[model samples]
Target: MSTLDTSALVIGVDFGTDSCRSLIVDTITGEQVASAVEFYPRWKAGMYCDPDRNVFRQHPQDYIDAFTLAVRNALAGVSDEVRANVRAMSIDTTGSTSVAVDRAGTPLALTEPFRDNPNAMFVLWKDHTAVREADEINTLARNWGGVDFTRYVGGVYSAEWFWANMLHVLRVDPAVRASVYSWVEHCDWMPALLTGTTAPDVMKRSRCAAGHKAMWHESFDGLPGEAFLVRLDPLLAGMRERLYRDTYTADTAAGTLTPQWADTLGLTTDVVVGVGAFDAHMGAVGAGIRPYSLVKVMGTSTCDILMAPAAEVDGRIVKGICGQVEGSVISGMTGMEAGQSAFGDVYAWFRQLLAWPLALLGDTPDAQSQRDGILHRILPELERQAALESPVDTGMVAIDWLNGRRTPFADQTLRGALFGLTLGSDAPKIYRALIEATAFGARAIVERFREEGIRIDEVIAVGGVAKKSPLNMQIVANVFGLDIRVAKSDQAVALGAAMFAAVAAGLHDSVESAQRHMGSGFETTYTPDPEATAIYDRLYRQYREYGALIERLSAAEAHPAPHSTELCTPN
Candidate 1:
């Protein structure tokens, strides 16, 4: 019905930890024509989490609601002709983020205590409750330096990743675990739902998720080995076998949408679904990363880095570094991922504590409208005022492991800490300290990567933090002593997913070709200032010391019987 040839549109959906977004992008120019974002309020504003401290898990239905809402809104703004021309739909979501489903393919965790229950829901990518099992994996893999899969990950694994949650489920709920008939990544399953398929043959599983999270391979039969999984947990032995399936790259056509899904969505069911992937990795592709280029997904939490390299580091994995198979990001080259444990979540925590009445600030709001009167708005203004107040006024620094370190060390039990606090400390000082801490966390990961011969040439920053906070971006540049590549598009993840769809539909021959042809926008780079860098270097040492002290305290709490006060660093 539509006659546009080069201007064909594609719907790319991003399934985030708290919400889902849909975007309509011009296939040839890669320009986003229209967009819609839907937030799960129960999932948002931190409402549905456990009373105790752990990350939030989402119901797959939440993503479904978001998918339908975002799709309708995206179409609502387009002309009927434009809608009809859309050739395909693709999706990206947080990696290894999954759910248990009944025979009918409905998410079982959505309705009950499972949403807040530690064991019942999808163990989110940032969740840390499974650290004990993760540590064992680390210990078991120590002899090999890390798993062969570590090549895709950064020669290190964390409890927050897919394997950690899978093992955790097996250990804690052994009985209920067997009742779990199926386990599918939210991004992988989303398209299957649209097309009516199962894990085995229904839709293509992303090589990014399959390689990075599920331990699938470009070269192997499937998974690492049943023996290794049995060592981690006996149940994981069976779990790995069940989840093992043929993996597909980002550009592969997963399946066509089913007639039922087409009727419900009010578009042709022939829409293509590319194999889905982790939001951040796809964010890199959407940003048009060249070989060995790094894309950092910045948000409440940060998935710091992913890249495609030119050559295989022959001894890279052998040097006790973590790596995954070749062509993890794209088909021709390998992709690697790493990140800071906390970013926006730290700021959200501070806002909750500081956003009180004027009496709370001990200063009156003079003549200001209530619209600009709240601490939420006032805090940014104060941070600006204080940054200019004195170079040392934003003097406090902290380590951002508030939710524990997701990488470099991979310790989840390690908590947050604020150093250099004084009687003069207030909301602004503490907030800036938190910002500096996350910047340092990024630097640590960057430093570690470069230390092991992995070159991170450009830091591509995307997500809520990078888009909204200039101060945070400035600090990040200063801390890393490197310029950052910022996405011109706000919805990098959604755009990335759509790029996959374009590849799947044969609009482009491969993801790499699609990235060049259809990926949107130029990058904005922030170079680090030398003066700021010098000051941060000294402050970073103290920040490390402060983090080490707290980690010792946490270690003591966990193993109180024979622990000393010495700080422990990773091997």
Candidate 2:
């Protein structure tokens, strides 16, 4: 493989929830030269999601299609020299999203008989259908006499994670279970797919995904013991060896781009593919992470990443957060992750909720067009009107758990709650309350870290929600009672992936050096307003109480008791 020297170019592919984006950057200057994005056609058509059941899947074909389209389009306008100068590429994807694969590493959905089966597709990160299975795993882990499997990850694991999804599928689909050889995380599989190393034994796994979601760690001597998997499900018997044991950080090369992929993308075969990582972790890198600097990737969901010196972390497990792993974000640093399951998703839900009525009541073609128009304007209008109101203006309060809680606990069974609604409440009033609820959820994560002895000295916001929503930016700042700096790059996640690509290709000796050269400076800073801060503090307390009540109600329904008062016990 050819190593990139000075003036070399690299590509960073960011696979998001809805689309894939390719970014070409100058290795030396970190300047983005060209970029392109293409939505997942099948996903856009709602082919793999059953929203009613909280089942979300993405076909690997959607990813393959987007891969070719995004990269080809991105390089379309660039000069031949620029395309040829591309020394390496790296990718970041949503996680703990994972997919079932055959012995050859092909996703089952890509083959016949399983071609249209959602169970055979890539399970998206937000899929919560495995809640019961996750609960079982947690119960077992807590009671096990052996080392806690959740030591590296937060104390609690979630249905949104890897093993839960895999076990859930195995139990539900005998055909899939019989055909599948092993499972691979999206972040790990994508790069391996590009490098033609999808074989279960040869495919490289990601430290970020494996450490955070699959409970793979050095202390455990790799994955959870084979006995643990068998205990969880007899169907998992002998599957541990099919999956990988070793994991690499994003700075390492998975392999050179395969000849087929190189030819398809009009790049040379020598282009290296860096080991992959989840989008938020790389986004944190793109946002320029420092010790105690919290990077919030505020997209459909929010992944809050923080890294600190390894000595400071002292191998202390920060309970109730996501995984805290070494080299997951930056090599030689301790990476900590926390996130809400839904952020922008909450807004999208509200939009869908309102649009249902417009679509049902107004059936004409003009009416359908009008409904689309209304949906487009609703959020922006709400933001404008809500910005004028104070926290007290609306007697409404919302809990940002529509997609369930991801941090402080990984309970998918809990649902969202909205209380204190009155006839006086209008669209904007309720909307503002929802926005505040999200900010409050974010604040809870920050506080959880502090409570666990992890300091967050600064907050950096990135992704679509951070750049587009002034109200959200200000509210989060006020809620945290700290200034929030928005990263300058709108494509920080992709840019961060590119930074990794540069390092893997030897253009930079390390990720820190690449970050120093390519780091996009801050674009805007949101300073907390004193008046807003006081009001939010009061409401935040109420939000927690309200959320607690909902949790109690959910638990009571799940396990009925004559006079149940044990629910929502103090943590």
TM-score of each: 0.89, 0.97
Off by over 4 Å in 1: 1-4, 45-48, 102-106, 110-120, 143-152, 199-203, 218-220, 318-325, 356-375, 389-391, 560-571
Candidate 2: global Cα-lDDT?
0.91
Give per-residue CA lDDT, model 2, range 1-571, as digits (tens): 3244665998999999999999998877778999999999999999979999999999999999998999999999799988889998999999988989999999999999899999999999999999998898888898867778987788898999999999999999999988999898888888888899989899989999999999989989899998888887888899888897899999999999888899899999899999999999999999998889999999999999999998889867798888998999999999999999999999988877766778665678898788888889988988999999888879888999999999877788888888888888888888888999999999989989988888888999999999999999999999989999999999999999999999998988888888888888899999999988998899999999998888878877777766755554433
Q: Candidate 2 at residue 124, lDDT?
A: 97
lDDT of 1 by residue, 311-425 (tens): 6654464222224446556776767666666788888777756654544444345524442457457657756754653336766777788777866756778888776678888
Superposition error at 265 for model 1 (Å):
1.2
lDDT of the candidates, in the order given: 0.72, 0.91
Candidate 2, residue 201: Cα displacement in angstroms equals 0.7
